[model samples]
Target: MVIDLPFIWAALIAIAVLAYVLLDGFDLGVGILFLGYESGHQRDIAMNSVAPVWDGNETWLILGGGGLFAVFPLAYAVVMPALYAPIIAMLLALVFRGVAFEYRWRTERGRFLWDWSFALGSTVAAFAQGVALGALVQGIPVENRAYAGGWWDWLTPFSVLTGVALVVGYSLLGATWLVLKTEGKIQQQARDYAVRAGVAMLVLIGVVSLATPYLNPVYLERWFAWPTAIFSIIVPALVLGCAYLLFSGLNRGYDLQPFLASLGIFLLCYIGIGISFYPYMVPPSLTIWQAAAPDDSLAFLLVGALILLPLIIAYTGYAYWVFRGKVRPGEGYH
Candidate 1:
């Protein structure tokens, strides 16, 4: 029996990407919510809720990217070129947002500018990520391990809608995080935002669900095909269940349930996408086996990945544990 090393690497990289999205995603969401908070104090409290762990949360992104480059160099080569614009934009936005995180408290004179920078940076980064996802799902032009698409191929209406959807989705996650991590009127305000954002997120999910099949017939086939289809429905059903639980928990004034539920929704959505594009890493183009690096190289990478992944997980868990509790105004990573 042959062990599929490439498949294992693919799954590992997928896990890393999902971890980044679910973890850093909320912090980014928190950054976006900074725009909604009019008071500097409110923003400060919100920022502090995530500040201790935001940088660590981003490590998964680096892991995911690095793993992809190492394990599936061909996919990296094709995808990087296809998504050059949005990827660069997202990187720049993240850089500015990280800068804002440090500088916002350094000088009163430029604080306002820094605050706007954080909010704009978060918004653009999230939108760019969604656009990139949309472009991938809608299909990138790849031929002979290269991107054959025009520069503007990624800028379509569906991709734009996905971008807006991600903004609202991230904001919802941010609001729930605030609800879980803060107290006082800010908590109440976050709850209100969560409810509204939840509604918007649901609508976007419906639109995306409908549009996905129209944009890609392969999705339609996978979604409605036999036993696989029956299993596939479970993902969306779980998402809806999470949404229901989130709303119920919010109404009951439960602090952590709503955030957990929001995370569950994101997890389910990620799984659904994975189901839609299981074999294909470059979406309708390159399959994992086709694009994977040599098995010998994968084996070498796997040994190092095994050693580092656990340490990263341990550190991340410890950081969250150390900072666990409701955040109060003026008590944070400043």
Candidate 2:
């Protein structure tokens, strides 16, 4: 059987990106939450909760980017130019945050500086990602397989709104993660943050959902069409259900359920996005098949991906399992 190599690669990249968002997202959320706490010990506990697995979680992002470059070079070419500024900013923020993770422990006098760097880095990175998503969803100007828009084309009110929304979303994820990973005062603080962030997230989701159709008509048509419309209801239904679970779980002092429920909300949001733009990779302009590289190149890449992807997943799972436990005071990356 002649396999559809392009489709397979597309699916693989999608999954990789989803994994990156969910895994790295919570850590980023934790970083954002650092700004809220005054206690150094409480912050230490939060840092330790994510310290072991955070770097490993970022590997999925690398996989997603590499897969895109290899399998859909055309899309990469167009997208990179369109989002050059935000992408560069995101990378720099990630570098700062990574360095903060190590340096915060080394210098007692500079710890405050490093802590701010970590929190600000995480916020900037998350916002840049959201801006990129907003720009893509609103449709970049593409002509002759190239970006036709100016550098500032990505700066818009909708993009800004999405950026703030993502900050709230990631903060929620981080708060839930703390709920699962820490105990005592830090855990209670995280539970409080989770409820606040979760409510803000729901409001942003509604705003984005309402604004999406107005920003682009295609999303409206795809979402409300007859047979598909009925299916689409499942997305919102699951979101509401998960939101309820998150709140109830936190209120009931269930450590793991809130985190799991927050993840469900993230997954449902991703699925809704996929449903809105299934065949299109560039939104209203480029189809997946149109952006795909040559079949022979994809076939070559697929062989390497098949060998490497499973191993990466196994290692990631193992790391999480090894680090499974509650973080306490005076315990961290030292």
Query: In order, what lDDT does every prediction score?
Result: 0.91, 0.92
Q: Which clashing pairs does model 2 show?
A: none
Query: Where is the poorest 10-residue window by lDDT in model 2?
Result: 223-232
- TM-scores of the models, in the order given: 0.98, 0.98
Deviation of model 2 at 281, angstroms: 1.1
Q: Count the backbone clashes (under 3 Å) in each candidate.
A: 0, 0
The number of the candidate with the highest lDDT is: 2
Clashing pairs in 1: none
- Residue-level lDDT of model 2, residues 108-168, one tens digit each, is 9889999999999999999999999998888887898899999898889999999899999
lDDT string, candidate 1, 43-66, tens digits: 899999999999999999999999
Q: Which runs of model 1 end up more than 4 angstroms from their true locations?
A: none
